[model samples]
Target: MKLVIGGAYQGKRAYAEGHDSIQKWANGETCPEEEIFSCEGMVDFHLYLRRLLQEGKEQYVREQLIPKLLQENPGIVLVTNELGYGIVPIDPFDRSWRELTGRICTELAEHADEVTRVVCGIPVVLK
Candidate 1:
């Protein structure tokens, strides 16, 4: 798998699209959960984690989702925002979402074949 990360509006999706010729793409904010495993690429993956948390599926995401994705679609590319930056959130759920996104992205990066961070539309490879 390949992982792309950056701050909001950093053009991570465009960078991933330009770098890979993936025909099918899913938006994590709206796509069905099962679609992620089969899509060629996905964007706003941090939002998906937020959704899972809001739906009370945090434990499943923490325990099974990543492993399932790796086993089922190891070639998929994921584009997520780096959510741990900036001031901490006052809302507990927001803080949990940010933390979960960070931890999950870290795990994904560790296993990803390539990892890229986009800054002002410039892609920087970190793995």
Candidate 2:
């Protein structure tokens, strides 16, 4: 899998699209949860995690999300906002969502074949 991350509106999606040549992209905000396992690429992946958390699927987040994606769509391209750069949120759920997103992204980066960080529309490869 390839992970593309950056601040919101940094053009991560455009960069991923330009680089990956994927034909079918899923928007995590609207696509069904299971679509991640089959889509060629996905944007707004952080929102997907938030939905899972809101639904109290902590176990799936901790135990299955990474493994299932790696197994089912190892070549998928994921574009997610980098949620760790800003000030901490005050709400408990917001805080948990940020932290969970960080942890999950870390693991995803570790296993990803390529990790890219986009800043001001430029991509900096991390791995």
1-91: candidate 2 lDDT, tens digit per residue: 9999999999999999999889999999889989999999999999999999999998899999999899889999999999999999999
Model 1 alpha-carbon drift over 4 Å, by segment: none
Please give, for residues 7-96, the per-residue lDDT of candidate 1 as tens digits.
999989999999999999999999998999999999999988888898999999999999999999999999999988889999999999
Candidate 1: lDDT of 84? 82
TM-score, each model?
A: 0.98, 0.98
Spell out the clash pairs found in candidate 2.
none
RMSD of each: 0.5, 0.6
Worst 10 residues of 2 by lDDT: 64-73
- Cα lDDT of all candidates, in order? 0.94, 0.95
